[model samples]
Structures are given as C-alpha cells and as structure tokens.
Target: MMFLRYLAAVPLIVLSCAGVPFGYLTLSSYLFQRSLPGEPAEFDFVAGFVGNVTALAGFWPVPVAFLLFAGLWWRTAAWPRISLLPSVPTAFVGLVTGTGWAIALGVALPLVSWGLARLAARIVSRPISGDVRRSAVEVLIGLRGGGRLRVQSRRLLLDRLPPPRYRESPVGRVAIPFDRIGHVEAGVVDAPAQWRFGNTSELTITPGPALRVIGSGQEWLVPVDDVDAALRLVVERAQARAKPEPRPPLESARWASAKKLWDLGEAQLSQTGQRKVRHGGHHVLLVLSVLTVAMTGYSVFRVFTDGWGFLFGALFFGAISYGTGRAWVSAGATQKLAEENPCSPLADDPDPRHRPITGWSYQPVVLGQTSDL
Candidate 1:
C-alpha cells in the first residue's frame, strides 16, 4: 500500500524537474556575466567547474521533492529510525536532482545533522534505574548558551556538546557527570537585562539564573522548573555515589588547582566596575538581523543599478534574517513560561557554595522527564 502511494506521487515529485534548467540558467548568467578580468587560468578552470557542479547539484527542487516524500514516509512508517534511513539516499538523489535541489539540500543539511544527532542520542541512551543515573526525564538540562532546557533523565547523556567519538554524529552530547558535582545553588537574582523586553509596564517575575552545579571549580547552569527540587536530586544522586575513600595526592592537587581558578572567577565577578557584558543567543540573532537589514539596504541600492535580480535577492535574504530573530524571541518566551517563583529551598541561597553537596534533606520528587530529542 505504501509503495503504491509513493508510486502515485512520483509525477508530482517530478515537478521538481523544472529546477534543473532554472538552476543551470541562473548559474550560467551569474558566472558568464560577472566581469572577472586578469584572473589566472587555474582560477578560471576551477571557477567554471564549481559553477557547473553547483548548478547541477544545488537546484532547489530536490529538497522540495525530498521534503514531500519525507512527509509521505512519516505518515506511513512505524518507526522514526526508518525515516532517517533515507538520508543515505539523499546524496545520490541530489546528484541528479539539479541546482535547485542542491541549494535546498545545503540549507536543510544542518537541520538534518541536528535531527540525526538527536536520533542517535535516543537510540544509544540507556534507561534510568536506581542510583545509576541512566536517561532521566524530569531533569531539564541547559548549557551555558540559552536554549530550551530539554527534559531528560539519564545521569550522563550527550547534550549540546556531544562526546569526542560522536563528533560527526551531531547528537551524542556529553553531560556533566553527577559524581563530580559539588554544589547545587539557586536564588532570586537579577534577570538578564535583555529579558526586560515586553514588560515595560507590568513587573514580571524577576528571571533568576537557573539551578547551577559547581563541579571541579566550573559552574553549569541547569534550567528546570522547581530548580530547588532539581538541585536536591542532583545533590542526592551525587551523595549516593560518594565514597568515603581518601583522595590521592595528585587528585587532591588537581582539586586545589580547580579551586584557585574558581576563586579567581569569583573575584573577577565581585568587582563591580570591571564586569564583562554577556550576550545571549537571542541578542546575537537580533544584532545579526539588524546587520542583515543594513546589508539589504545596500542590495536595494544595487537593484537600481543591477536589476530585479538584486531586488528579489535582497528581499528574500532580508526576510530570512528578520524571521530568524523573531523565531528565537518566540522560543525564548516559551522557555520563560516554565519559570516559577524560586521555591523555599532554592531561595535560601542565591550564591552557589564551593563545597560538594552531601546529605541533602529534601525527599526526591519524581517529576516526569521529556523524551523529546
């Protein structure tokens, strides 16, 4: 039945056939019309070869066909893993697919990498049982950079930063080990200044820094609801794994070294006049969007001298930049929705302790964890 459905869609998929000629023509015009005088023979040969290849490979229709077929497969396939199997064929599909397909694939390639990485993580991640920190569901892990604090349960799992071995896989992130965790701190702190947007009149809940873990003198921010509870869980988990065995001289020395760095960081942070400005992901996107608008203005100016090509290009590119900024802002807002008033346990200490958490008093709360990759 699925095969018959795919067969029926073959003709519509072939509508992408128009992309081949369109891509070739666009590239030929761009390459031939551009005035490149006094260039070396090697450079010309390379440039011509690249142009031909790009036109043949990058044609936008290929991705449209792929996306269409992907939707078809998604509806019929029982397992998500099966859907990813098609990625191997994508390279072959793009080769004959044309310039439009190639360009579309290039754009989607990052999302593809990210998707595969997440999928790989799901496949390899083990289930949580007892004190062994397996894949966790309730724990919302956030890295230094701002992103949605994805809920997971594993004691150690790949996050934004994948392990060295899965470097190309894009999904296997190495999480901070609970065994090394020394401190879990939370408090009502001043929210980042940029978060002050859209709340000019009403006093919004002061967004505090999320639960922080101090380990080996470094701090990791964990964005989770009931941050105090999460802190207790981490502390409890760490304590459960703690051994009374004495530390080796070398190990103690490394701890001492890490302590010095931690103290140095604290001293720098305490100094009011010499503060470094922090920029979140949203801020970066907003800045880039503004810059893109300025660049678009230049392109618009070029349109008067060049043609409709520059005009259309500038509009399309400009919209993409603006759209990215808007999208990031929306995502940030959704993440903020999870924020709650700092619970009593967390509110007790805004400043994270340098010492390792041991013998936590609070009972563990079994909050549900998300399996979203």
Candidate 2:
C-alpha cells in the first residue's frame, strides 16, 4: 500500500529545456494576447524583437536559446505555460513567428515535438521534450521513488530530496559537482511496473535498467527509461568536467573489457606454458579429419577412373577434410588426454594458438623460455 502511494506520488518537476523554444514562444504569444507589461500608446516593438530574438521570458529569448541549444542552460521552474505545452505552441503562433506562419508552425512544431518527446520519454521513462542530445532531462532517483535528478552541464541537482529514514532530517536540494563524478555505470532493478506517459501506457518494464552515478564521495541510482543513452550522457559529461581526454563510448568499452579478458587468458597461458581453454569436440574433429582425408584421396583416384559423380564425392570429402583439420588443430586437445578426458582444459593440443598465445606453433619460439611447452 505504501509502495503504491509512493509510486502514485512520483514527483514531476518541470523539466523544460528542449521545449523551451516552444515554451518561450508560448510566453511571447501570451504577452501579445494579454498585452506586454508597461504597454504605452505606441506598442512595444522593441520588446517584440527582443522577445522573438531571445525567447526566455518577458522578451529575453536570445541568451536562453543559445544556452539551451548548447546544453548549458538548466532551470527548475516552468517559464510560463510550460505545463500546458501542447496548447502553448498553438497559443503563441501569432506573436513568436507572426500571424501568417503562426498556425502552421504551432501545429507542426508540436507534432514534431510529440514524436521526439515520445521517443525520449520512453528512454527516460518520463515525459520530456525537445532533442535530448542537447537538452537536460529529469530522472527519478530511487528505483520506485526518491527525488528528481536534474542533469546539468557542470553539476547534478537532486531536488526535493527525500529523507534517508522516517525520522526527521534536514531536507534540501543536493548539488553534486559534475566534475567530481568519477564512475557513471548502468545497471538494472527488479521493479515490474507499468510506465504511464499520458492516457496511454506502454508496457516495457520487467527488470528495468537504471544508471548508478558515483562521484563527489556520493552515489545516486537514477532509474531512467533509456539507461544506456543516459549512461552515455553521464559518462560524456563526467569526462568533460574531469579531463581533456574522453572516456570510450559503450560499445568500445565492452570490446575493451573483452580484450582485457583475452589478455588475462594469454598471461595465464604464458605463465603455465599451456592452454587451459575448455573447448571440446577437437578429438572428434581430429578423427573425422583423418577419415575424410583418407576417403577424399581414394575418391580423387576413383574420379579419374570412374565418372563425374566421383568428382563431386572427391570435392565434398576434400572440403570436409579441410574444415575438420583446421578445427582439430585449433581445438587444444592432446590425443592421449582427449581419449582419457575429452573435455579437460588441461589437455594440450599441439596447436600453440590455443587458449593463450605463447607459442611454438602460432608465434615463433624465438627464446627458450616458452620452448618447453
């Protein structure tokens, strides 16, 4: 019951950034409709230009657009009518882009934003707007409920932060300097629940993935819709704050870890003077290879004396012989050991290109150190 209430009470702080342009335009249009503050006999032509140019609020759209576009701007509060964003663009068409282009842009922009918002919202598991690539997103801190995690350029703000315990404690927004963030990792939580975007609900959670951010001597687990992309955002931002050098992207990091594992295997093989890879079926391949080779040699002779059908048999046997031979040689199995325990990792196949790359067969045994094995 408590769990249901917390889930129901998921705090929604206004995460207006990408849609700021739309939101800003909404602000300008409202001013024209309601008349701008300090209106005189001569209407505020100067404010209109400044409002169109800046688009922040109250006729200051320029710096806000540039900063928001650059991913440098982040604000907690809705500028004006941001919550009513769907109606905002249409409402602002007359002032922001002029009456002629207002209706078209108002409708068109929202449609485009609706599509983008759908995609990004699905990723972050919450409603969002604008291009996420250059905008900020709000994330839930706990797997179920905690606080709003507002990702900014140089810092991360945890707003309306919940108390650690039921006992009374000092509750305030916690700001963790982005530069201090060291490790930004992706993981999952076992919270099977439905994500409600609007009236529609997309069922896409079982073991939903979340991001674990650790830095500045603190750690935060952020449950987002798109954990991988969000992880990349945190990684990129952390690197940007910490060093001139960049951290590897997700795929690259995976490959690097795999290579490290291979390297460890190679090091072990070097020290042990043998391959310990537990790959099997090499002994069977060896027998099949010998049988196929003998059969192919006989078929080749029969092809010359017999018919074209014999030629096909000879070619088939030859291909099988080659494949089996290559696999057998690479299988890391010894004849005696394979016969005793075919699956044993300790069994040595004469192929030095085995589990580890210490070699007589693969690489030249230039030195006597690895010559024994």
Candidate 3:
C-alpha cells in the first residue's frame, strides 16, 4: 500500500520534468554555446567541469523537485536500515529517472522502488510500532540536512518571534522551503496587507532553503510558523495515539453505512490491482507516452522566438502526461485504501505514530503516529 501511494505521485514527477527545458537551456548557455572566458587553448578540463556543475547547481528547479519526491520515498520507505539509500544515491536516481521519462520511467521507477522498499523493510527494518518520531519528517526539511527532530508537543514559538502580526493585519508570512523561489503572489486573509499565514498560495520553488511547514498529520506541504508550532501541533495530534475520541451514536451509524460502501470499493479496487499486475497493458502505453514527452521538449524548442502556437506543444504534453497518471498508481494502493477502511480500528485517526512506514499516500509527512498514513 505504501508503494501504491508513492507510485501515485506522478505530479511530482511531472514537476521534475519541467527541468527538461531548463537543462536544455543551461547546457546550451553554459557548455554548448558558451561565451568562452579565455582563449580556447586556455580552457582547462577541471575548470570547465566545475563551472558547468556550478551552472547546473544554479538552475535547480528540476533537481529540487526530484529531491522532494525522492526524499519522501526514501525517508518513509527505506530509512534506518536503508539509511544510505536516499541522500547521494537518491539524487542520482532522480536525475536518471527525470531524463524525459516524462511519462515512462517516472511511473515505472515508483512501481519498482515501492515493491523493493517494502520487501527490504520486511527483511532489514523492524516496525517501530506506535512510534511517530520516525515518520517522514526528514523528507520535509531534512533533505541532506541532518538533525533529529525532538517532538515537543504543545510548544509554540509565538513568543520567540515578534507577535505574529503585521500592523493591524494578520501577517501570514510563509517561510517557503525552496532555495531560489521567484514570482510569489500571496493573498491576504481579511484584506491586502492584512495577510494570514497558512493560506494556499502558488509557489515557484527552487533549491536552497524551503520553508516546508508540516504538522497535524497533514501533507508535508502545509505552511506553519515554526518547528515549535510543528511540534506542538503534531504532538497534539498524536498525543491521543493511545486512545480515540468517542463519536456520537448518530455519527457512528453514518460511519457504519459508509464502511459498507468502502468495503465494496475495496474489493473492486483489489480486483483492478490484480488485473494490472496480471495483464500489464499499461506497460506498453507507458513506453509510448515517454517517447511522446521526449518529442514534446524537442518539437517546440524555440517557444520564445516561435509563434504562440508553440505553446500548444506544452499544452499537449501536459494533457498527455495527465492522462498517463492513472497507470502510475501501483496495485499496492488498493491494499492501502483497504487498510484505511472504517473497519480498521485506527482508520479515522490521523496519528502517524502507529504506522511503521507511511502507507500508500500522497506527498508529505506528518509528525507522530497517524492511522491515515
């Protein structure tokens, strides 16, 4: 199920694919059509390689996107025993996978890795049951940055910083966790200048420093104030891991009815998963899709100089890529959804502390043992 969840993250794959154009441009600008710094005879191999790497580092939209995707999988899936799997190797793997699989490799790699990680976990890693501390929080900010996060429940940083308000407005300053972000447009809650934190805003994320505010068993992408708030909110969420809140009889009846529907859906989903694993029709389709995306980057290279019609190439690429996403969801997702069915004792709980690995789910990590994981 955990594998299925990661497999479903094709959007992240597409985001990384955007690097295709950037890589093209960077290479063209730096190496291929470079303005040589000195006479050709003076060009040193070591200097050239280092400079190229630096230029590549400067254009990091693709790598950062892939890093997020890889980190999520590595921390939640591999971890501990697979300690060395993610950091350097994950980066290299992401780069390899992002090479215009635009459709093919993106889907295939997730499916393959998901299975491997699970199998490895069963062998090398022991489930730290009821343990929330080891959740994929590392995926959020600890990408390459190392330090254990000590969960301090109920700790707030409102006092550590200036009162969390700007003038009369509720200043919602999102410390986005990207290194080189551009063109930010944030909305104010009450009015302009009267901003609020945590509002959903479009982010143009690049590598350096991203302010990923994860907490309360939500996806790793939520914007929070500080780690203190993260600890407080996350711990508050999982602090109830040992017990559950009693729902009213009416709610329970409604939940029971929902459970019946969920069970039926689960059976159908399991069948579908089985069909995918058995028939494998999508494998061929995936190959075609990858070829299509590679063509997309090539077909309309001169978007800036070419007429507006070139934009259609990008649109076509997007539509085709979007269509290919369903094939990416692994069969394990069926089991994941089934496990989270109402029949499960922890189905309604958001505490990640209870799960060993983050089960099949979308991007991000919550602090603590969550049932939904």
Candidate 4:
C-alpha cells in the first residue's frame, strides 16, 4: 500500500511542476497578446501547438517512467540506492550544456547548474510581510493568557466588554487578568521599586488572602473568590515561567565545608575594603587546578592529531564527564550539609530533645529551598 501511494504521488508531483509554468506562460501571453487582432497566423499556430505540448507533458506518464525505473533499480541492487533519474532542472541543464559534457562532468554538473536551480527556488519562494508575522506572534501569545491580550478587533462585541480590561500590556506583555488583581500599592517615598515591564507603574497583588508575600514591593490587589484559587494561579504562573535555574558551582563534602570557610573570608575582606579574597580550602583548589590542566592538555593533543573529528568526540566525552561530576558533587554537598546541620527546618520545635539527627527522613521538604528560609 505504501509503495503504491509513493508511486501514485510521483505523477501528481511532476504534473504540478509542469502545470504551474504552463499556466503562468498561458496567462501572460493571453494578457499581452489580447490587443493584437491582426497577429501573424504563424504566431497563433505556434501558440496552439505549444499549449497542446504543455498539456500532454503535464500528464502522468513521464513521472511514472522515472518512478518505475527507480523501483526496479532499488529491488535489483545490493548497494545503497542512488537516484539515476535527472530532475527537471538537471534535464534542462543537460539539454543546454549538451549530453557529452554533462556525462563527462557527472554529478559536478549540479554545482555548475546551481544558478538555474536557485532561480527556480526563488520563483517558488515568496516573502511574508512584517505585519503578517507580527499578527501571528500576537495571536499565539494572546491565546496563552499569560501576556496582556491586545484587543485589535474593535467590533461591537469588544466595545460592550467590561472595564478593568484583561489585555496584554503594550510593555512587558505578560498575561495579567484584571479580575485576579487584589489591591494596588504604589511605591514608597524613600525607595521606589523598579518597574520592569515598561515605564508603567508597578503593583504587587496578593494573589489570595492567606498566601504570604515573600518579597514585597508594590503589590497589585487581585480580588479572589477563594484562597485556593489564588494560590493555584500564582503557582501555575510561576511554574510555567520557571526554566531550570543555574546550579551552584561547588560540590563534595570537603568542598562544601570549604565554601563556608570561603564565604567567611569574603565577609572579613569586605569589611576591610578589600575587593577580592580566596576562600575555599587549598586541597580543593589544587584538585580542581590539576584536573583542569590535564583536560586542557588532552584537548590540545586530540585537536592536533585528528582535527575536527577528534574535537567532536572529545566534546561529547567532556559533556558526559562534566554532567556526571556535577551530579556527584551536588549529592555529596547535600549529604554533607545535612550532616553539618542536623536540625530539619520542618522540626516542631527550635531545639530537639534528642541527639542531632543525620540522613534523610521519610517526609519530603516542600515549599521553598533552605535559602528561602
């Protein structure tokens, strides 16, 4: 069935290619020669003959011949299939350049024949206007409901729409429906919160009644019928916008401890008006430096010997190594941190009655990360 379909499609493809130029020429001649009442009889006869030839050529037999030959060749050959048939452009080139030169030059003809192929490709390819592209983007973004919806269609239905409109802002273009808004709080006198979207005023809305406003600026007040709805909406928006955040650099138990030490050193240096300071343990630095130098040397050797192929292989290997190393380091760091700070943030009391706890508990940590606390 598949083979039959493939065979059937070939005739249609050939006909389409042939018919388009035929129709175009026919229309152009009709438009230009319509005024010539006393045209030469030879011209009329030649035009009729060309039209008939074009109609016959656009029929199915020509493409069927190519398809049948291809199928027969493929079934008989053991090696990879190579298309023996010449395409329209190829045939045209062969006709113009003559069969002897084409056969001698072989496939090299295509590169020389690029000018003709490119001209055909250009005639088929049409440019889309800027307005069309912009309209497409607007429709896509507006439909998603995150960005402001632009009400471009100002018909009677739109005019009757309620005030406090939900539309994409001309600025940031994020979707913020007016009904979800709670209260609008303006920026303060001393320190004004930055307005990100546009030059438009910023407002922080408490999504619902109970949800805590973690970081505050100017809050836009949304009227929510239920607390759960507000929380769900905020969470949904945050999740949708959240791409994978960048991971921290250091890993390993020793490296984790070294980072704390480094942070302490940075604090001390900052107090003394120093611009830079080294913090991590000497052993961590030494290990990292040695690894870096070894990898760099290996990369240089591979490049000199095998060029691009070696470099590609090395890059693939390096990516896998880096990812594995990062995962190991992160896990080690997490375990070490848990060991150092035994008191879980979710613990009922500030101080536990028993000995300091270590290792994972059955309960998972929800809400934000330790940094948020």
Candidate 5:
C-alpha cells in the first residue's frame, strides 16, 4: 500500500514539475496543425505562445497540486481498499496550463462529478426540492442534526456520510415547507467563556449572526452568517412558493437569491476592515520570474559557448535558492497576516469550538525541521 501511494505520487510530482507546458505544448501543436490545416500561420503562433507561457510558468502546478494530492492520500492511505481514482482527473487537470482545453476539462469534470453525485442521492432518497428537481439551493455549512441545511429555500438534503451513522439514521430529512414555516429568527450568540490560568476569560466571538429555523416542532440552529437580506428573502420566497396562482418570478428574487445576499454580506464585512496592510508573496513571484528569465538567458548563453558544466551548476544552485526563497516568503506572509488579524481564520487559537461555532479552523503549523528517526 505504501509502495502504491509513493508510486501514485511520483508521477503527479513529475508531471507537475516538468510536463506543464512542454508535453502539452507538443501535444497541442500536433493537434492544432492536424485540425487546422488551412491556418498554418495562426497555428504556429498559437502553439509558440502556449509553449512560451508554459515555460515561463515554471513548476506549473507543483505548488498547488503537490499539497492537494498528498493531503488526500494521507487521509485514506491506511484503508485496505483505498481508491485514488477520483483524484486522478483533478491531478491531470493541474498538470496542464490553465488555458484552452485544460480549463474546459478541469472545470467540466468537477461539475459533472458533483451533478452525478446529487442525481444519485435524489434517486436513493426523496428529492428535497419537490417540483423544482434541480433546486437552486446552496449549502453554507453542515448541520450537526443530520445532512446540510440549505441556505434559503425550505429544503434539506440527507447526509452523504459513510455507513454506520448512515445505517442508524431513521429519517432522511426534516423540512418545514413554505406554508408550513411559522416564523424565522436570526440572532447572535456571544463566545462561550474560556478558561485560562484557572480563571475564565471573556473573548468576543467573530462577527456574524446565527440562524434559527422554527416551525413544525423543529428548531434548527445553523451557525452560518445570518444576513438581513437572506432572512428577508427566506420569508419572501416562502410566500412566493406558497402562492396558489402561477406568476413570473420577481426581479429581485430572480437575480439575487439568498446565497447571493449572504455572499454580499460576507464581502461587505471583509471590506469593512479599516486597517490596511501590504499584501504578501507577489514580490517573491516577481523575484522568481526575474531569476527564471536570468536562468533562461544563461541557458541560451551556455548553448552558444558549449558550457555544459557551468549550465548544470547554475541549474542546481538556482533551484536550491528558489526553493529556500519560496519557503521563507510563504512563512513570512502567513506570520504577517496572523499578526495583523489574530482572530482571523489563519491564526492559531486555544478555543475548542473555534471551527464549529465560528467557521474559523486553525491553520496547521509546519515546523522548520523534523528529527530523523
């Protein structure tokens, strides 16, 4: 199993590092020339542009793809019958440049996967969104009660969690239909007291109101943002859906759904911050780009001078410096951000309910070194 994991990871690592523009460039060039026989000049220009872009975008998907693949594998590696097939498509998508067919395949495959999963769920259990089979419901977060609670519409989907808990489940969902909904309430809860030095300390919870759905002997407390517009839309949509006669959708209701309103509120809150700090990591990228260009120039020089030894030395040394610089810059930026906003999701916290209550999960700390076994 360990051998298989290492084997699976090796190819993805190699592809992310070297396959990006080069392999795709070659494949795309051949494809374009064959497909567009009449447009030879256009094809040449397109192929050359893609190749150059990929070359410039060094280590194409490595930084992002490496972490994603490793994280997924770590979780399921212990399972005897683990399947890494679901991650294959995404891994492939990350190998290519973020353009042309790559973009289409990357984006389309994930959407199709999600759609198919939803379709299967509907087939197995009763469809949550009655007549509107494909209901426009967005899940803000998972509810402890069972499945996730839909943001606006009076709908709830069953849990997709693995067996045991699923087997013991009696009911798939509990939803208060539009007309059945008695009243909706939104309010804020103060952070629970924290113990420090054997004494309680009062700490203000992160910004945002919580939602409470009350009707049909069920009251579910959802710990997501409770924007006024979202709460108002819930009432309005319920009224609309409950109406006896059919009518065209209202203008506000058509474009701005409950999810949109929640997103707008989130944006507003983020922008509400008065303190401004210089953003991080762009300068690191600028340095990387400059070094890459310098390396490219040297490669050209070495080709003319036939300086193989110097070329190899520069390549190895430059890679080490680049890796060191990347690691430093990433750490520095994260530290700066955490220092600036201690309560931000990126910071460390001693609070146990940090994630469940506030949706602020603690970021994992990466030590500078680990002792050898």
Candidate 6:
C-alpha cells in the first residue's frame, strides 16, 4: 500500500515542477516559429552524455553522504555501531528510482541527519549544573518586602535567570525567599512565550544571580545566587501549605459513560489537524492551477505559428512536471506523519502526540513542553 501511494505521488510531483518551463517553451515556439531539433546531431549526443554522467555522479554520492551522517550519529549514541553496507543498499535503491526519488531522498537525508544529531546530543549532554544553592520562602499576599524573585524549574537549562519576588493577592501556596535567590530581575527575559500562558501582564521578581527551577516536571529559569537556599525555601513553604480537598477519580464506570462524549471532541481535534494539512495542499494546488491556465493560454497562442506542435508537447511535459511536484510534497508530508505515528494492526489506539504541523496544532517547545504562550 505504501509503495503504491509513493508511485502515484512521485509522477504528480515531477510533472508539477517540469510544467512551468515546458509551458514557456511552448509559448515561445508558437510565437516565434522556433524548432526544438534544429541543432546538430552532435548536440543531442553531448546532452545525453552529460545527463548520464550527472545521474551517475548524483547516485554515487547518496550512499557516501548517508554513511557519513550515520557514522556521525553512531558516535554520539550510547552504543555506537557502523552499518555502511546496509545503508549503501538503500542508497542504490534510491538511485534506481530516478531523479524524483533521488531528489526526495536528498531532501529527506538532511532532516534525518538533524534528527539523529539531536537524539545524540540529548544522550551525550550532561545535566544542568547543580553547584549553586539558595533558599525559597513563602511570603504574605500583597506584601511589600518581597523584591522581584525568579521562578525556576530544575529540568530546563536554557536562558534560565532568576526573577524578582512579588506579592500576588491571595498569594499562591508556596514561594521562595528573596535571600535564597542567587539573581533576580524585574521582567521575563528570553523565556519561551508559552511559559507566560498567554498572560499579557508582566510580573516582576530579585537577589540578582542566575537560577533554574522546575515546575510540574518542566524546567524554568529565574535569577538566583544560590540554588540550595532557593530549593530549601521552596521545600519549606510547600511543606507548610494547606492541602486541597480530594476529588473523585474519573476512572469509574459512571465517569466512563460520560467520557464517550469527550471522545467526539478528540475526534474533532484530529479532524481539524487533518484539515490544516489539506488546506496547505489546497493552496499549492490553487497556485498550480493558475499557472497551468496561463501556460495553456500561451500554448494556444503558439499554435498559430510553425513550431506549434513542439510548443504543445513542451506544455504537456510542463503540466506533468508541475503535478509531480505537488504530489511529491503531499506524499512527503504523509510519509513524515506515518513515520512519526506508526500503525499497529492489533490495537485501535491513536497516538495523542501525532500532531499535524499546521494551524493551532503548531506549538513551540519550552522546557520540553509545548505551550501556547
């Protein structure tokens, strides 16, 4: 099934790209009465030779590049392994599939390399520095003494500076002490906007050194001078806070009955994600359609001239090329989704993390969590 889909998509993509120039040629031939084969036989011979040489050179490089990247990735893994020969077969298969296959493989290889690099980095990189120590304390709501203090999470390491402490009305259950903070600032620095939760109001927090913190399993940064002191204060306050009332578990049969309606909501969300992908494809198709019309118009004009037939042939090729380009893009997107969310034959499970790369589904990662802010 996958192979069949790929076959259908490849030609469409190739045709889409080839259409434009072919159309232009068609128009030119009709208007100027030019011939496609007016050149010497030697020109044909030379073109064929060049084409063959280019194809061979292009095909040969695929395995080499793939092996190089694979080796680089392996070195970064916990257990490095070499499989150059295995990769070579795949590269050869790509070569046999012609220019479209070669082009797609070329584009996909870099992306795959990037993914491997990221995975390797994650495996090899050290955890955040644990040297600094600070104290955290709970402060009264609307209190004046709490200078700006940063909120931080332990899990994140990037751009994490301490923030100044402030008193909010009915202040939250826990707060870290100002003295425990290593660094403090008045405003949010290069923090991922999602951390703000779409809140427009700026909050301030201060000791004046850099600090990192974790909240709800995610990492955040704040200015702090001492990590130990800040952590102590936070621990102390959290211990002192009043516990909330217990809620009923939703895993029971009664709740399960009500959950059926929520399943529909999930379905809606999935549909929306799919629609966004299709909408992007629709935009591309619309552009191609407009270009096709323009090309056809040019070809019609050329029909009155001596080279009309050649112009029409080129136009046909151009259309095929344009179609191929579109199909290729669509198929590539589908392939990415499929790879990310492999199907399981025995279970009817849908992966919740399989988000389409469009519309509101598109999100920025902060401390390893996707956030809207």
Enumerate residue pairs that collide in model 2: 54-61, 54-62, 55-61, 56-60, 56-61, 123-225, 123-226, 124-225, 125-225
Model 2 ranges off by over 4 Å: 1-146, 163-168, 191-207, 243-373
What TM-score does candidate 5 get on C-alpha atoms?
0.27
lDDT of 1 at 135: 22
Error of 3 at 132 (Å): 8.8
Ranking by lDDT: 2, 1, 5, 3, 6, 4
| Candidate 6 similarity to native, TM-score | 0.19
Per-prediction RMSD in angstroms?
Answer: 19.9, 28.5, 21.0, 22.9, 21.2, 23.0
TM-score of each: 0.29, 0.29, 0.26, 0.17, 0.27, 0.19
lDDT of 4: 0.30
Per-residue error for 203 in candidate 3, Å, reads 44
Model 1 CA deviation exceeding 4 Å by range: 1-98, 102-110, 119-140, 143-177, 180-209, 212-223, 226-229, 232-373
Q: What lDDT does model 5 reach?
A: 0.37
Residues 108-215, candidate 1: write the lDDT tens digits.
543453353344333332222333233232333443334333333323221332121211111122233444444555543344322110111111222453454443
lDDT of 3 by residue, 1-373 (tens): 3344344444334422332233323333344223456644433555554554566553333443344345444343322222222223333545564444333433343344444444433322123222323332222212112212222221111111112221211121222111111111111111111111221111222222222332222212222224333433344334442232233343343344223322332223221111111222444444345545654665467576777787788778756755664453432233222212223333332343322122222223434433453
Q: In terms of lDDT, which candidate is strongest?
A: 2
How far does residue 345 in candidate 1 sit from its true spot (Å)?
A: 27
In candidate 2, what are the lDDT values of residues 72-107, reduced to their tens digit? 113322222222343343446444656544555555
Lowest lDDT 10-mer window, candidate 6? 164-173
Assess each prediction's global lDDT (C-alpha) against the native: 0.38, 0.41, 0.33, 0.30, 0.37, 0.31
* Candidate 6 deviant stretches above 4 angstroms: 1-279, 306-373
Which ten-residue region of model 4 has the weakest summed lDDT? 152-161
Off by over 4 Å in 5: 1-148, 151-167, 170-173, 192-208, 243-373
Q: Which ranges of candidate 3 are over 4 A from the true structure?
A: 1-48, 51-237, 240-301, 308-312, 326-335, 342-373
lDDT of 4 by residue, 1-373 (tens): 3234334434433333333333333433444355457762333645754874565564332343334334332221200111222234444444464444343343343332333323322222112122211121111111111222121111000011111111211111122222222222111112212211111212222222322211111122122234343343333323233232222444534434323322222223221321222212322333343344345557768899868656765675566556555655565444333222222222233221221112211111122321221
